[model samples]
Target: MDLQKRFDKLKKLGLCDRCLGRQFARLGYGLQNYERGAILKESKEIHKNIFSQENIPQDISPKDDCFLCRGFFNKLDKYEKMVIAALTNYEFNNLLIGTRFPQNIKDKEKEIWEVCGDQYIEPIKTEFNRLLGKRVLKRLDVTVEFNNPDITVLVDLTKDKVELQISSVFIYGQYNKYSRNLPQTEWRYKNQYSESIQEIVQAPFVEASKAKEGKFHGAGREDIDVRCFGKREFVLELVAPKKRSIALKKLQKQVNMIQDKVEIFNLDFTVKDKKKELKGKRANKIYRALAVLSKGIEEKDFKKLKQIVGTIKQDTPQRVSHKRAKLTRKREIYKIDYDKLTSKKIDLTIKAEAGAYIKELISGDEGRTRPSVSQILGCEAKCKRLDVLDIEK
Candidate 1:
């Protein structure tokens, strides 16, 4: 159908300026639909279609009589007020506005599309969001963020209700755990330790943002008995945060100063994708372990410790078998350095692939770990103390 002929048909349907202009919305740039409709009403096509030389058809219809929108656009002000009132207790920097029209409104628009051919028309929902967004920006002194809005206001014209969805705030950083008793994240301590590295880092963020809860994401985790001197990447997510921002540097300093178990640095605002990336990332690690041997370490056996390199075949240790799958894992041992601390003990430094169990490597996990430190020394060995020295960049 020709655009002019379609316009004549829509004109007879008693559409207001916005509804009529929306039918030809794609034809013009930098013009509102209402303005476009008004402009088209004076065009030569309108002169030929519905009016004689001396008579013209009604160019604009009253709100209540518009067959397409049925005065829906007129209530944008009411919806905007409802949105503003719903946002009274929240704090945000930017927002996105959306609308849900009644089924009848959708049906009316579909009926128009069947006749108008819909090739160059803008959706009523699209126009509603844009107009309401502009109104909100002007009134609230805030900007509109389409990709990642801090708050999303949903207006339901059918119910005449407004609802809000507040997005979670993500913070990225690295943490160092100094206490050997603390777990990497919150878990049952078995009455071992009441605190955790995650709790220490997330308390300040949850408190400052007034969030309902906080979740922790780490690049990898360290065992409860192993202190991590190397910085481990992590992301803290605050759900339903009332406020969007807090002083990053100040908060980092506060956590570092107050927490004896864990300290954080390089704290900065981040996106949701960073959390997924951090969780998937893997890095090599270095560790120092004190292995207590069942017998005295001979000089020949000590030299064999240097040969603890290349691929290692290990099964899940008995200690963590309940949580971890029972299967063999192959990991690379990059390097090993050892010193004879006493007749029955040795200080061993190891660099290996991530996910390799250092405690099992030293003790051999009752022969679950093949060619480990105990197997090399020809005796039973157990790690008494362990510490992470570095993580590969």
Candidate 2:
């Protein structure tokens, strides 16, 4: 049968325009289900059965319950008010609306579609999203965002409740650590309190953004005793921020107050994807170290050090094996150069692949790594001071 015939046939069983019009949701563009249903009901194309105003059926009345939605459309005002109240405390630019209908409501939708032969019909979820989105925009003056919305309001029609989910805010920057005493994240050493790079960089941002919590993600980390001399990239993700407006310059100044330990620069707002990039990044590293040798330095030692090129197979260092699994890894050493400062002390520069253990490479780590400085030179080698000079892009 044609659309008018189908509408006339379905009208015999009670349905509201919001519910009845939804069956033909995809047939018309830029028009809501209620408008479509009202048009169909009053159209001369469909024959109407006449009953006096006093004898009209209760199911056909405008205020009657919807078979498909169970009065959900009639409760839009209540749902909208609940969502608005839930969003009053949050600051956001764009918004999205989600709904969870009861199982019986969904079953009714399926049954209706099956009886109507499922032609040009949109899902109930889509209609609810658009309807709630329009209402929220009209009231809150906020635009709808399908992707990466600042906040999402969830309406649970099953329980007659509303919930809100706030997206994380990402900020990107480069930082330098002047103190070898600080770790990249918080550290608890015995009873003494030690500072960390994460605390220094992210603590102020949490307070400034009025967020519940914050996490720092670095491109790479330096050891507690090794200083990061150059710009080290990082991202700070703030969760459920109440204050979206932030002045990065002022926050940077606040973060840099502990200049004696660490500093941050080139800071700016970034996106959530930055965290993935940092996690997947494997940039080469340049390091400078002061090495103390058991024997006096010789001219031939420099040549042997230069021979420490190509792939070096290494097992996890003993110092960190307690926390890390014992596994063998192959890492490349691009180049090795050194300058003698004393008979037993020398400055060494190394360019290597990411994750190469410089300290273990110098000490040989009790035969855990092959072709190390100590193994090649036949003496014990120890790194006294180390600094990361550069990280390749």
Candidate 3:
């Protein structure tokens, strides 16, 4: 039958174009239900004109009530303008638009589909996103990003709200924490300090690097008590950056002055593609730990540790079992050097695996860790302080 007749029946029950077109979903491509309904309405009017040899009655007004969309589909221009205004503060090359509808609207659409015996019908979300996306593309002139969009404009029609999801800015570089007692990322407290290491580190780097806010991603992390001494590989992902290129040497110098513990090295610009590749790569690390013995030990026992240096069987430490899987791993000790600082304390230098649990290796985790410094020497050895001396790629 003609859309006017169908509208007469569907309108008595109340139906939107998005709702009406959903019943005929199998027809057309790249077109929303409202657009499809509009086309169907126009075509039906044209058909009546030719057949009856007179103008068909304008029985259905364009502003007729729609059960599903509630006539909000006609408000596309207003929503598009809102999105453009929301995006003004951020810089983005690609964007994706999303829409959400109320439960009642969806329920009404479901009722219509059921009445028509589940014929081809488009979804409410599909029509909303597609129509809004098209309008945004035409008005804003921004490309759509499927995998990693610079911005995601979420149009929540259900509550009449709009939200902008901005992607983070990315920067690849190496960092060296000259001093100790700082975490690589922020440390959160339930009732205390809420800022993290990244917050402190990135603010200066953002100003120095002349980019948006930055997020720090390192190949690995050291204990909060430990300091990063040499070149530590890191990637800083900036979010909605205003500027990209900056003087790296000067920025590095500026970073050094603010926090004596943190410094950016090998500063370079990088794209999103490079960031993914660096995520899986590993780098060599050097650690210097101060070992304290329960009792004074002779130099002879220390030499014995050097003998078995190259062969160390390490497994996942028990202290980290809550967060890590239980698995046994073997790592070459590379080398071990010790300098006598006192009778009870000695400076120990060790090079091992990238993910090695260095602290547990010294304390021995109550015999769970075998061939440990305490196990090998038959002495209780504990790490008083640890420092990451170097990181090499």
Candidate 4:
């Protein structure tokens, strides 16, 4: 509890003004540690002053060579330049500073804390980040964004290297998949090129941002074979983008012009949380499905489709059981309206709840689904082609 005893103990360890000021960080408000340490270091004549040590150890140096920081604090200019040089390739407005202390330095800091008692002392890492961030702010036109930073400058004292961690840029929009062959995300068969709606949707944004890659996050994804005619909300996450600013209309045009298979619209800048929010919203789907039947013809068959409206108890489909948990879920069919295409086939417009296995609902998935279209028709039924016509508001 004795301030003088702690000050004297820290001084005996050959700490610089910054390191010394850091020990009493809680004592002064709105003042850098080094300034406080300088005032205390220069004061003399006892009473309430920090007396200058006349006979200190020969091995222990002053500000240029301190036992605590080991001259690290004095080299802020060097680190600032290194960070700026690293930032040359990155375009970031909100940045954060991080520090990685060497093990030896950490141990030394712990020993210092033990000797002086860490009652009101700030950790070395905190001071390091603060001091370094202060240095960067003076020369650069950037602000420190703690929650969500565009980029992070990591000054690893162990390796003595400056590393930049550029954050992903998020773009919110809606997309329609015209091609049924394309998957929602990238497909890999060890080493094979597979085209997808995700790749197609992100092509222009990635090109503009000069990002390393792009990831697609949809509100709810449809099957690979199912074509989505309705606009599905999505977030395109571009990783390590050198440029955050995008020409929205131009990028949308480039994406729409790339191919007729996929079209993106209303592209706008979004935060990282938008991805989570987009995924959390569950929306029902209206599907226009082509159902092929084993038995043919009758107006009575059209009436059978009406019986399918209500709660459907469905088990996990065989196709997706490998990735999804094998569990029974209760989903619903809001409405079922059909147009008898031929005696053997019919076009069904079904409004179903979210997460309802549409294919399983039609084929009944080997009796895995109850009150299904296949069960209602009194014959074997299979969905040949499916298209999402609309998403319920």
Best by lDDT: 1
Off by over 4 Å in 2: 1-5, 28-32, 42-64, 187-193
Flag clash pairs in model 2.
none
Candidate 2, 323-385: lDDT as tens digits:
888899999999888988987898999999999999988989989989899998889999999
Top-down TM-score ranking? 2, 1, 4, 3
Question: Residue-wise lDDT of candidate 3 within 305-375, one digit each (tens)?
Answer: 77546656666777678878788776667777888898778888988766766777788878766678888
Measured by TM-score, how close is model 3 to the native structure?
0.67
Score candidate 1 by TM-score against the native. Answer: 0.89
- TM per candidate: 0.89, 0.90, 0.67, 0.89
Worst 10 residues of 3 by lDDT: 46-55
Q: Per-residue lDDT tens digits of candidate 4, residues 1-393?
A: 577677677777767777877887776456667666666666532123332233222333334546678778777788889999999878888899999988888898898888788866888889889888988977897899998889988998878899989999998998888887777888432134377878778887788899999988999888877999779999999999999888989988987986898988888889899999988887999999999999985887669788889999999999988999999999989999888888889899999999998888999999999878788888899999999999864
Sorted on lDDT, best first, the list reads 1, 4, 2, 3
Question: lDDT values of the candidates?
Answer: 0.84, 0.81, 0.68, 0.82
Off by over 4 Å in 1: 28-32, 35-44, 47-67, 187-193
Worst 10 residues of 1 by lDDT: 47-56
Error of 4 at 15 (Å): 3.0
Model 4 scores what on Cα lDDT? 0.82
